[model samples]
Target: MPKSAVVLLNRPSLEAPPHVEGAAEFELLDVDAPHVRVLDLGVTRGDGVFETISFGAGHPQALAAHLARLAKSARALDLPEPDADAWERAVLAAASAIDPAPEAYVKTVMTRGLEGDGRPTGWAYASAAPDHSRARSEGIRVVLLDRGYRHDVAKTSPWLLAGSKTLSYAVNRAVLREAARRDADDVVFVSSDGYLLEGSTSNLLLRFGDTLVTPGLDQGILAGTTQGDLFAFARSQGLETEYARLETRKLAEADAAWLVSSVRHAAPIRRVDGVDRAVDTDFTAAVNSHLIGRTS
Candidate 1:
């Protein structure tokens, strides 16, 4: 089975099939078939947390960072803490099952389990990543959509799970769909107060003159692993970096901006709100090299 296939894993019977005993073609399952009860909050109420780690060179890049975020997300949901050792084993097994040639998206999802049982339903697996070569090379068109929340919402509403990367992604997907209706490839979400937040699935980054700026974490944005890594790399390269609140109008004055994430990496935003922005391929190349390092 290809890694991309959804293999059911039953937590009760944690047994690997014979074909999965050794190296298999894209291992998608490590245990028996799994079936979630219809009443499970994870599905019915979208009560869960997840992390997507970039799998390459036989292991996940930024494994520690991803796991840390997963733990934080789980805590935010009041779900059971993640078993790092077990997750480590599952992730390694899944990554090893993939064909060695292709880069993969390895995800770990933990839900609040059944409505009453209280046991968390967690699994880690690898899958083929959707190709973003065109967007990476040619750049992407984006539109700004109001996130419909104030920047201070996180501080005032704990139940909202503001900074948590929860599984409740319906709104995010809907926003992206709306962006598509506007003939845009992606979306940059801004707060109701006109402060830049983040993308539907990525962290927003801007290059303002010689300085790099990203929205401050206090604004209720999911902490982006990719953005954190890139910022460290940028500083090492002697670029000035700042984490401050930004207005959507900053997009117009930016030398360049991108929606950076673990899977898509760094993709330039050529057009914002149907208006063309700057594109610096050389800068993108340099940053990508720093982001992924020279893998030989």
Candidate 2:
């Protein structure tokens, strides 16, 4: 289960796996090929959605919680509900296919099938993404944007382009490009309401003094999987925590901040525009101990 630093998606070398109908039942067509299965949640009228989870190597909780959150996220999206039993079966099947001695990142993506003639073609798919562990420590740089992606989806966005990870990732890509233009590594969006939403691909966090703060989900932010665990770990260790509408000024003043997600884990925020600061603190050690069961 050795994961690649960067997965060659366009260059899928692993063989396609047989149909993955349930969670525990998956089969790779070949060792050198990557099998990406498809499941359709028949929604043609722009109501499509999916979730991604991170089950870190050897640590079962990450994956377990990810699955639990996946079910909840599916419910939140209000699309067709996924069969839990089938999901469980799929997980087992996928894991069985892997060599357990080495574990890689496991991701499950569910999407809404094509909708046409003013409706959707009923279909949904999920895939176990190949593990890419390199992004965790090297860190990701992000650009801050004045505009945010709080759109109404199914919800025609660029017709034939749904933003539910269903299809249209153009905007997401564009945002990244914009970030690149600004000399930043990634992007973090600020709402007109003045609350910090999130990065283009993940959640935002700030460690203020001894307290950790983030924007609440009420602000149209995606509930981050790693963020939840980080906060939980922080609380367990006697650190104060809070979730509320965040302002750009507060983030600029934060002692330390990070953009978190499954793939990147936590990328420290080095500097915010108009606010020059140094990112010399290492919360990674503390966070790693709390997250991965490593003791100092």
Candidate 3:
């Protein structure tokens, strides 16, 4: 992944990775009046749709699998999916921009669009943003916070609950930004009910000696793909995987902790507010091994 250089905000141009470059061409969808366009509202508003996929070297999974998942995610939100041709085109665009030898992150967004007044018209468009991959290999620190939308379950779309990756994300983004502001690498969000939900942009997990514990989707987690992979990986390693309600305190008490996602892959928690973060030695390898996936 290319490290994003701090060019002036007003710079004439900027070089971005495949996902980001693919997203820059969001005009293919018409945002004109009454068309009910789907914008990548997740980039700003909390209301939109998005997906993250892993891309390394020149290889990404074949289109069928990736598209099926994308389509499911879209149908879950009842959002319009790109036509097969459009989806393929976007994939190719994103793929073409990928550095064949590089490991990177790809995020795609589709949101409702704007109105004739030029303001957000309640339509949607999609975009992609890819990034440098090495940091996931290093590790990042995250601080936990007690914040999230209560309607995260009931009022939101049924198929979308913590699963659809919608964009109406002001709270999540603000929390993550605050974490960065605190000089922490990322954020972990706890619910008012005292259950550990997820990191700002990742899924939360911990190892309680022999069991791998992650909050259940009933606890309002985002149903992470990486978390699912980790579960399978844990089971294969003879580790027990459990999805139960997790107390935030359990994170600090666990033998090890990780915030999993496509961008971070698997971020090791190095710090926690008012708690010690040094993980138990026995759990380190189990924590790191889950992110080493090579295929679908």
Candidate 4:
């Protein structure tokens, strides 16, 4: 199996091996070093916060936004406040070490350290991004899956970590697996009452003529960095945007839809639940050009 090239942070003594073949370009740095202990809560109970960022030509685009989101996630978990300065330095170091590839992903993770320890274990690394050409250009088939929660669960059930992007993704992964079993490429998670929520790993966006629609942050969806950024970009281009309670049936009524993320950027959805829709090439290109191309 091919492995992604990685660059370790805060561990100077470790040595990274050479890169292995993979879907996208990457460079390795310090692959053999172990950075965490078995007793850490992050590993033991999936108690941690994370952010995935996209870097191109050695520069991290939207890095500040990602770090801000990471801090919010940490706060939601009541973990120790992250040292943003330190994380920024580490991310830059990793990015500097990576040989320039078309693009790569840098994921920063901060776990509540050992169960009894107040210190948090935080580190970051740079790796190759997964190839999303097919999904981006050819489009993807998605299935709607029930998230088994009410849209307002985030407000009523804070313990659910509703809007936080934590390391606990067992349920999210399971939903994607189910989507695969249904012969779909991705998922759009809907709430129990039939409101569209988000994707297992990405945020959902729908196009209705000149408008871009997404489930509101109040609906318990992880406040998506890419989605928010794209909305801003779209509005700058004179496109109207909205945040509303989307029904499952709304998928078939849209001009187009997409699953957006940091690493993958914006992937157009060609079909939803086996129903085909016309791919809006102009809309996709405009949105992606801003979302993926704007690296500064």
Candidate 5:
């Protein structure tokens, strides 16, 4: 089997017409081949939605939640609703085609196809995940940057697509570069109005005594699938969970913190703007163990 695999969906959305009149639901393709068109809106305008699902021992973690989020992102972009069953099958197929590993990820993307084509392009690409042991164990240094939006941006200006996980992530990538310039590893975006938002590509999680708090969804942050699972796990372990509007100062005051996401799982925040912070080593280990052992 190849180290990586790709499955191109013929009909990403049942609401829209198929790519071909009569073709298979999807096709396994060469990972190195060019599949997208130059004029595709997803290529030219970054008009699309995506979800990256991590697989543990070949079982895709939080598969249902990821698909639901993908559909939600599609709705936010006014794109056709993704066919969950089809996407699930495609993801599984791609996952199976790749070499078995302790950790792997399958990324599903649905794009607004060529202008006026009225058809969308969708595919799932699977590959073994990168080694995140160093960051997960030693933790990461984070810097707070201004996201240039208000906490109420999602409600006030939904057109900005604040909470949607779209293909346009230039700003997200730029934040990491800025963090690098500041001698940090990652970023936590603060709203222009002085509210803590989220990480560049993950959700902000903080520990306050025995409670785990994260910025509320209303703050224009993506509803993190990994964070959701972590919340459930925390509850099972007798930790209280909350979603609230957090101020920038809250990050510094927290007992321990992390930036949680799918591929990276939970990376504890050990430093902020060069200042050291405490890390809950025991809890972090337990969190990662549960994440890596998930079968559903």
Candidate 6:
């Protein structure tokens, strides 16, 4: 079996017409070949939405939540509602086609097709996850950067696509380079008004004694499915959880902090802006253990 797989959906959205008449739901394709068109809006304008779902032992984690968020992001972009059933099947097929591993991810994308084509392009790509053992155990250093948006941007400027998980990730990628230049491994974005937001591709999680707090969803950040699952895990372990509008100082003052996402699971923050912070190795280990052992 190949290390990666790809499944192209014939009809990404039931609300839109199929790519071909009477075609099967999806078709497995060569992972390395060129599949997207040069003029595709997703390529030209970064107009699309996507979800990366991590699977453990062939079981995709947070499948329902990821699909739900995909649809929500589609709605946010005024794109056709993604056919959840079709996507689920595609995700599973792509995942199973690849070589089994302890960790892997399937990225589902729906892009607005050629400018006037109307038909959207959708595909699910699966591959074995990278080794994140170092980050998970040793932790990572992060720097804080200004996001140039207010905490209320989602409400005040919905047109800016604040809370939506769109394909335009130039800024997200740029931040990582900035982090590297600053001698850090990652970053946590702060709103223009000094409110904490989220990471480039992960969610900010701060532990305050026995409580775990994440920035509220209203702050124009993607609702992290992994973070949600972690919250449930925390509750099961008798840890309190909360969603609040956190200020920058709160992160510096937290007992411990991590950047959690589907693929990386949880990476504890060891340093912020050149200041070394204490890492809770015991709790971090427990969190990662639960995440990797998840069957659903």
**Greater-lDDT candidate between 3 and 4:** 4
| Cα distance off (Å), candidate 6, residue 2 | 0.3
For model 2, the superposed segments whose C-alpha errors exceed 4 Å read 1-27, 30-48, 76-78, 99-103, 114-139, 148-168, 274-276, 293-296
User: On a 0 to 100 scale, what is the lDDT of residue 140 in model 6?
Assistant: 96
lDDT of each: 0.77, 0.54, 0.55, 0.79, 0.96, 0.96
- My TM-score estimates for the predictions, one after another, are 0.89, 0.69, 0.68, 0.90, 0.99, 0.99
lDDT of 5 at 213: 99
Rank by TM-score (best first): 5, 6, 4, 1, 2, 3
Each prediction's Cα RMSD? 4.8, 7.5, 8.7, 6.6, 0.6, 0.7
1-296 in candidate 5: lDDT tens per residue? Answer: 99999999999999999998899999999999999999999999999999999999989999999999999999998899999999999999999998999999999999999988888999999999999988899999999999999999999999999999999999999999999999999999999999999999999999999999999999899999999999999999999999999999999999999999999999999999999999999999999999989999
Q: Worst 10-residue stretch by lDDT in candidate 5?
A: 111-120
Candidate 5 deviant stretches above 4 angstroms: none
lDDT string, candidate 4, 158-270, tens digits:
99999899999889888878889989988998999999988888999999988999999998898888898899998988999999999888988988899999888888999
Instruction: Estimate, for each residue in 172-219, the C-alpha lDDT of model 1 and write its tens digit.
Output: 899888999999999999899999999989999999877889999998
Cα displacement (Å) at residue 246, model 5: 0.8
The stretch of ten residues in a row with the least summed lDDT in candidate 6 is 112-121
Candidate 1, TM-score vs. the true structure? 0.89
Model 4: lowest-lDDT 10 consecutive positions: 12-21
lDDT of 4 at 62: 85
Evaluated at residue 247, the lDDT of candidate 3 is: 75
lDDT per residue, candidate 6, 1-296, as tens digits? 99999999999999999999998999999988999999989999999999999998888999999999999999999999999999999999999999999899999999998888889999999999999999999999999999999999999999999989999999999999999999999999999999999999999999999999999999999999999999999999999999999999999999999999999999999999999999999999999999988988
Of 3 and 4, the candidate ahead on TM-score is 4
